[model samples]
Target: MASGNVSSVTEFILLGLTEQPELQLPLFFIFLGVYVITMLGNLGLLILIGLNPHLHTPMYFFLFNLSFVDLCYSSAITPRMLISFVKENVISYGECMTQLYFFCFFVIDECYLLTAMAIDRYVAICKPLLYRVTMSNQMCFMLIMGTYMMGSSGAIAHTVCMLRLTFCDGNIIDHFMCDGPPLFQLSCTSTNVNKVVVFTIVGINVLVSSVTIFISYTSIISTILQISSTKGRSKAFSTCSFHIIAVSLFFGSAAFMYLKPSSTGSVNQDKVSTVFYTIMGPMMNPFIYSLRNKDVHVALHKALKKRMFF
Candidate 1:
């Protein structure tokens, strides 16, 4: 591939999740349902938290932002993904970059936001006396803002680096979405800088967030164990249980997808891993939080009953 050819390339074909004709329609329907659930569940949770005065606490405030991030995260990839299943999956270079940018933004935002939520839980459980003072409204707002800023900065770094690489090779992207690893594989120019930048930024982001969550939960669990009553321990564990489940799913899938050596992993494997976080994670988060959470269940029931009475 010549430099001129690379410079002239304006679009790329997405190979999508699979090449089998028989699987496309089935996968399409499956992801379509996932997208719909993700949207409705996250949006409903957002509205519920906003309208219910009882939920106006630091915990629910973090949850509200989580719902918002899930909504955007799923939207960024799923809609384009659905189109690929039914039609041609050609994406212009610019559109692909845009998709990658937003995808990175929301995914990173969710990472740090989950960390912040864990810290909130830590304060609530481990330092109950200081919870209110530590996680004040202004403080919560700053935490949320910081997560978004971190996400944006990482996204910009990745996109800007990607824009520098030339793509003269075959324009076929092996995966469904414009992901960094797959995109790097297609670059005609040296992707050493892009790879290093991605690894560094992602490493710092995931490491900081994961370590924070781990430390926070360690303190939280220790504090829970100190509670004398079985009921007290169960209640405290229950509060963080849903968060633990969500964080595991989000971070576990993400780490497997991004942190692994790209050469050692097959594209098919990558697709499956990506599906877990990108499609399934968002779809399941609202249910994970709501079904396991007694307060959310109570608030939902109350809201429904109020609506029925009206």
Candidate 2:
């Protein structure tokens, strides 16, 4: 029992986004504003989707999930960070793991959900009449459930692997939140197991989602080329462009931060790049989807009008 005792590290001091005292307040306000926008944007999108019956397709079903993910994702980190900026920047071990768990869950779920959304678009655009039949209510529900399960599996694997690693001395995490990469870096024990598990889980996530999006888009392009009307082609492209941009931002930054060995970059650089996916990506998601898509705009307007009249 004595030999197997895990060394206790109760609290971790976050090095935070920056070291400069002068920059701290400014950055705090900036991130605070970003968090506010993320919350409102995502919440607004959720309300819009739920209120408008017309937007109740598989596409908006996934978008609703995405809005939920964004809200949870931002809430997992931003509030704590705002507090830390004003005074203390410490997190208990249990709290850290909890944050890491949900953060991983939402983010990884987005990868799968986004892929599912792409496939939905592919079915809608390419298959047309078969869209309703192929992407039935049951099928959509199953897909959402499957995506959540996949996300939970990855988060559980990484967090469990992290639990095995001993953290004896240093308790500083050099990032805004409790993420896998930074947490793994602080372990006193050899992190080979954690690394292997993370790599395996993340690799499968990135690879499978990438391939799915690729196949979806490839077929989508083929379908578009067959359409003779320029207006029809443009409309189809517009509908997908927002999703493509969101995917590129989320996956591209995620790949850059996690796909490579940790030794290649400084902790500071790593923290900054992580901001893109963890923070900026969530902030941008609802904005990208809602602001750019006409259907979403229409839905938003109808919902607002009903609220105003009622």
Best by lDDT: 1
Residue 234 of candidate 1: its Cα lDDT?
Answer: 95
Candidate 2 lDDT by residue in tens digits, 1-310: 1134565687888868887888889989999999999998999889888878888999999999999988998899788777767776889988999988988898899899999999999999999999999999999999999999998988898788888877874788878888878887678789888888878888899999999999999999899988999999998998899999999998998888888877697888777778888889989999888776778878777767887999
Residue 227 lDDT (model 1)? 94
Top TM-score prediction, candidate number:
1
TM accuracy, model 1: 0.97
What C-alpha lDDT do the candidate models reach, one value each? 0.90, 0.87
Candidate 2 lDDT trough over 10 residues, lowest sum: 1-10
Query: For model 2, what is the error of residue 309's alpha carbon versus the real structure, in angstroms, after optimal superposition?
Result: 3.4
Write the residue-wise lDDT of candidate 1 on 1-310 in tens digits.
2355235468988989898999999999998998999999999999999998999999999899999999999998998888888988999988999999999999999999999999999999988899889999999999999999999999999999999988876788988999999888778789999989988988898899999999999999888988999999998988889889989988888888878886787889999999999989999999988897777888899989999999
- Candidate 1 total steric clashes: 0
Error of model 2, residue 58, in angstroms: 1.0
TM-score of each: 0.97, 0.95
Clash count list over all predictions = 0, 0
